[model samples]
Target: MTSFALHLLRHGAPVLPGRLMGHTDGEPTAEGIAACAAQAADLGAAHLVSSDLLRARAAAEAIGTPILDPRWRELDFGAWDGLAPDRVDPDALAGFWADPDANPPPGGERWSELVARVSAALGALAPAPTLAVTHGGAIRAALHLLCGFEQHQLWALDLPYGVLVSLRVWPGARPTAQIMGLYP
Candidate 1:
């Protein structure tokens, strides 16, 4: 079995306020950029990857490594993209929570769609230690695949700003992850 390490890093805080930020290009805050630099210093991997979004890409760039920007961006919240979750229709939100895989956001990509794209991205990476800086939703999707957490359980995973979660991928098997919150 090919043993490869996959480090999943969530992006830092964005400059936008009360915005969903899905598919939206938003830069990270000054603190966010500093946090990324600090986190990058502790990372030992040579390979790096990032979402196309500016927030994630900035973080990846701060790592001082070549990045593979993939089209598998965060889940498209569509009309809800810039709105707070609480501001969205309650029924719509509930429907999404109850059956996320089936019920996509209004004009947004479904969980299943995101999963497929992310899985493909995972397959495209070199079978070596790699770092992927992305959004919380992407991290949650990876956790679902790695740890068998149901969609509803995704909420339980607290992905802090600039946090790093390490996972080992064995070919033809599920990945295993160890989440280290904001490692220095």
Candidate 2:
């Protein structure tokens, strides 16, 4: 079986810095775009894709023309969208943190749902070196889908803005991948 590199790059910092930005469509700061572009500049990926949101798309455009895919969008926080952590109920937030599937944000997507969505997106990728400029949440979802990490385990990773995760994937009906590298 042949393996290809799949790079998941988190979008740069959004104009709205500290908030639950899922589906909020915040714009990226100029420096943030520059940082993301610089990080991806030398990656010679054969294909590039990005989330349809402004933050991700703008950062991706700084690097190159990217295929826009909504499936790469951040996890939907629904009612909690754009609110700061301090603004939300601590108990509710804790519930979400403890088990996202059972205690998703008021109207948000479940962890399993995010995994499923990312799984579909991953399944559709061609077996070639690819890079996707997307959200931290979406990147985590992809990690879960491809690497089989549980939601809690995924939380341990510190994927800040402009982070990159490279994976070696063997594409198939049930694809599998291994971590090749992680770049901050």
Candidate 3:
């Protein structure tokens, strides 16, 4: 059984900060680029993967020529893609939070869908040490899908800009992952 190491790196700060930012491409801030590049330099993964979005792609590009994969994109928030938290319908947002899978945002991707997409990507990259430069939501989905953590339990895990979360994966038809560490 060969174990592989997977590092999930959150993209740096976006130009439009404090917004949902899903599927809405935005430039990375200067500090975000610098921080992600610096952190990426420290990671020595054989392969680099990233979301196709601008912020993640820019950071991944700073590290190396990453394999841009749209599967790594942030959760599609649809109508609420670029809106601030306060702007969305409060009841709808509450329903989304209460049960995201069963109650998606007006036109957003279901939580289960995000988990499934990220899980498939993780399963495909099972053999080598890979660095996935992605978003906080994707990382959260991985945690939920791979580690069996409940959605509510994920709130305790702080995923900040340029955060790195390493996992040891035993890849198979039903893959399993053990958390290695978190680098903020």
Give the number of the best model, judged by lDDT: 2
Q: Of models 1 and 2, which has the larger lDDT?
A: 2
Q: Output the number of the TM-score-best candidate.
A: 2
Query: Compared with the true structure, what per-residue lDDT tens digits does model 1 show for residues 1-184?
Result: 6777788887888887456788988878878867876776766776888897888888777776556565447788888886788889999888987887677789998998888778777767777888888888887887777667788888776677777777777645455545444352
Task: Using TM-score, rank the candidates from best to worst.
Answer: 2, 3, 1
Deviation from native of the Cα of residue 80 in model 3, angstroms: 0.6
Question: What is the lDDT of every predicted structure here?
Answer: 0.77, 0.91, 0.89
| Candidate 3 Cα misplacement greater than 4 A, ranges | none
Displacement of the residue 175 alpha carbon in candidate 3, Å: 1.2
Residue-level lDDT tens digits of model 2 in 1-184: 7999999999999888889999999989999999899889888899999999999999989889999999899989989999999999999999999999999999899888878878878887888899999998999998887888888999999999999899999888788889999999
Candidate 2 residue pairs in backbone clash: none
Q: Model 3, range 1-184, lDDT digits (tens) per residue?
A: 8988889999999988888898899999989988988877866799999999999999999899999999999999989999999999999888888888888876889988998899888876848888999999999998887788899788678899989899998877777789999889
Each prediction's RMSD to truth: 2.2, 0.8, 1.1
TM-score of each: 0.88, 0.97, 0.96
Reference-based TM-score, model 3: 0.96
Worst 10 residues of 1 by lDDT: 175-184
